[model samples]
Target: MRLGAHISTAGGAYRAFARAREATCDSFLIFTKSNRQWAAKPFTDDDIAFYKDAVAEHADLHPVSVHAAYLINVASPDAALWEKSYLALREEVERAGALGVDFITFHPGSYMTSSEQEGLDAVTRAMRRLLDETADTAPNTVVCLETMAGQGTNLGGRFEHLAYVLANAGPSNRLGVCFDTCHVFAAGYDIRTPEAYAATMMEFDRVVGLDRIRCFHFNDSKHGLGEGKDRHDHIGRGQIGLSGFANFVNDPRWADFAAHLETPPTEDGEDGTTIDMNQVNLAALRGLLASSSA
Candidate 1:
């Protein structure tokens, strides 16, 4: 399992590699710039060199993926916001490629005012255009659409939404999905039992093809099935529980997939003083594997 957390890129973007190494992460996610803001100073040549060197030094942290800015809303019914979001996403993809990151994932965005169909089409079109514009620039980095908790009118709560986006993008360009366990549960795909987990995965495979799923955001939900809430809890401590994760963790099919934690970090990195929640959660996941295989 490629296990890690969303580590901070506070001092410099390249520092995230060292932090991943410190956390004992095989892979991790980081925001190349600010998560809340759109404007960034740009990644200088030195910055790229340092990042590449750090990544090379930590061979285990090979596929450090970028999480796109939080403010992007390409599904916005407002034309101005949509355009701005499209441009920002394009910039994000380009930057991630330049840094030689493995993947860049983004929220599928909300379709609040417009009809869901229109919103899906809008997002799909934007993806196609972004891929076209960054064809040569960002060819290596895969653009992944993340599964979302069904908060308000977010587009990716259902598996179909992601399938539609991929269908429109076609097979040639770089495209994929990031399946979030908590979001699927909040959207009503139960995985607490073996039978239920199999059923849910079968449905996903039918609609989107499991091969298209490149990464897993391993989290537990604070809410129950179909709750539409977006709260993430510690692994095994939430409603989804241990069995939900065990089934996925031990599956032979996804043996090589990355399972990343978005759980809250230990305050001030104090262990004994403050718990390393990531280590705790990762241990919980590791414990599940034996039972699942048995």
Candidate 2:
């Protein structure tokens, strides 16, 4: 797989490229705007030009993606919240398209007060509308439904949930999946051993098809298996050790895929100073790759 991390776009979206390069990323994920906000300042003509130029200069950082704002929850039964989420997601798609990103991944949404079937149906309708409305604008960007940890009433804890949306959202080239390691492990899919990994993947293929996976969030789970939590820890330092990661890094089927690290940074110096842990975590992952080859 092409290893990378979620690079922060703090100063400007264009600056993310430099930060990614600093961490030696082969690809990367970014938030086009503030992930916690509903509104953002419009991108100016100069901003667009500089972003495109930075992408050109860093030609090696291929297959970049944008994670949609966390506030979107299209599965809500409430009419107002549903409409807001649909619009927010639609805007996110347009923004990702404008940036020429390959994919836009998002949490599938929570059922909250509704039934699982109701939530599934709502998400399907929203996805259908999103694809139809953005066909022209987001022609090259695929909407990836992320696997969740099943915290509270969230959907997508099972592969079947994702399959429901993909199967019912009508046939479109703009739909896919982003498999999150921490979420899946916390959701009960084991990958700590070779046999367990093979079984879990077999189940995924049966339910969602391996071809639908376009991106990955390579995080380690802080909680144990089936804990249904979303805590992220450093690679190989949490519940999922290096052995679990080895199965993923060595999988030939995903050799060309973009696997991004979303792990937290660590403190490396005295006086509680923090360090960029992307380099550290990515190095550990690379070590797994090297050992497998050896």
Candidate 3:
């Protein structure tokens, strides 16, 4: 697997590549805009050029992904909110295309008191609309729907839910999946042991099909199995712990997938509290894999 993290694009889109490099990442994830807000600053030609140049210089870094804003919820029952979500996502797709990113990962929305079938249908329709609108642009940039935490009325927490969305998407190659470790653990897919991990992944292959998995958000869970909570802890520090990540990083099936750390930045002077945690996680994971091979 190409190891990396979600790096900040504070200066410009291209600057994120430098940040990823500093973190010793072979791949990275970035947001095109402030994730909390509905509005985003328009991209300039310079932004596009800079991003293209940076990516070209980093040819060894494969599978760079763009994470969609948190505010979007395609399954929203509120029509206005759903429209806003669609437009925002559309803009993100265009921006990602300009930057030449391979995939854009987004969360499938919550139902908000709507029936499960209704919510799934709404998400499917919205996704189809997105594909139609952007048909002429960014054909290579696949939109990856992330699995949710199953909190409240959220959809896509189940592997079958993601499979449903993919199957409903028809023949479009623009759709894919981004699996989050914390979310899946919270949604009750056990990864704490090698046997359990194999079982869980086999079930995913049987349901969602591994071919659809494009990216992974590598976070440890602070909550236990079946907790339905979405708290993320640093690698090896949380409930899922080091063994869980060991299983994840050692898996050959994910060799081509972009594995990114979304853990919070560590504070100054605190032990293990730095962005270098990405490097630390990578080293630890490598050590584990080496021992297992022995």
Candidate 4:
């Protein structure tokens, strides 16, 4: 896997490349605008140029992705909120395309006050419309549906949910999945052992073809298996121990895939030194690779 982190774009989107390089990232993820708000200042032509130039400068970074704003809920049953989210999501796709980003991932979103089928149907409609609208403009960019922890009415806890969206939304290449380890584990899919990992992956493949998975969110769950919570901890310090991660790190199938760390930024130690957690997590993941002699 190409190990990395979700580097912040606090200043300009171009700055994320330097931050990713500092963290020793092989690739990275960034939000095109403020994640908390729906409104964004339009990217000027110079802004897009600078961002593209930075990406070329860091040629080693493969498949740098964008995470959609948190407020987007394409699955919302409410008309006004749904329209707002769909519009925001559409803007996200356009921005990604304008910057030549390949993947833009977001949660499938909460059903809230509706049946699961209704929520999923809403997501399907929004995805279809989004893809159709951006077909000519953003042909190369794929919108990825992230796996959620099944908290509250949030969709995408099950593989079937993802499969449903993909089946309904596209026969288009623009739709895909972003698998999150912490979310999947919390949703009751086990990967704690090699056998468990194999089984879980097999189930996912059966329900939703492995080919649909385009990116990953590498996190460890603070909650246990089947806990249905969304808290994330450090790579091996959480409920998903090193062994579980080793299974993913050493997998040849995903050797070229980008997995971004969404874990905490810094950790305080006994000596009062602040540790760079991304470096620590990357090292831990890299260490999982089998020795040549083994």
Candidate 3 local Cα displacement, residue 274, angstroms: 5.5
Question: Which lDDT value does model 3 have at 168?
Answer: 93
Which portions of model 3 show Cα errors greater than 4 Å? Answer: 270-275, 291-294
In candidate 2, where is summed lDDT lowest over 10 consecutive residues?
263-272
Could you give candidate 2's per-residue lDDT for residues 137-220 as a string of tens digits?
989999999999989899999999999999999988789999999999999999999899999999999999998999999999
TM-scores of all predicted structures: 0.95, 0.97, 0.95, 0.97
All candidates: CA RMSD (Å): 1.9, 1.3, 1.8, 1.2
Off by over 4 Å in 1: 267-272, 291-294
Residue lDDT tens for model 4, 1-294: 999999988888999999899888999999999999999899999899999899889998878899999999988999999999999999999999999998999999999999999999999999999999999778899999999999999999999999999999969888999999999999999999999999999999999999999999999999999999999989999998888999998899999999999987788988999988999999989888987315
Error of 2 at 273 (Å): 5.0
Error of 2 at 53 (Å): 0.1
Ranking by lDDT: 4, 2, 1, 3
Q: Judged by lDDT, which candidate is best?
A: 4
Over the stretch 143-197, how does candidate 3's per-residue lDDT look in tens digits?
A: 9999888999999889988999899977677899999999999999999999999
Per-structure clash totals for the candidates: 0, 0, 0, 0
* Candidates' C-alpha lDDT: 0.87, 0.92, 0.86, 0.93
CA lDDT, candidate 2, residue 294: 59
Question: Which of the two candidates, 2 or 3, achieves a greater TM-score against the reference?
Answer: 2
Task: Give per-residue CA lDDT, model 1, range 189-260, as digits (tens).
Answer: 999999999999999999999888888899999999889888999999899999999889878887788878
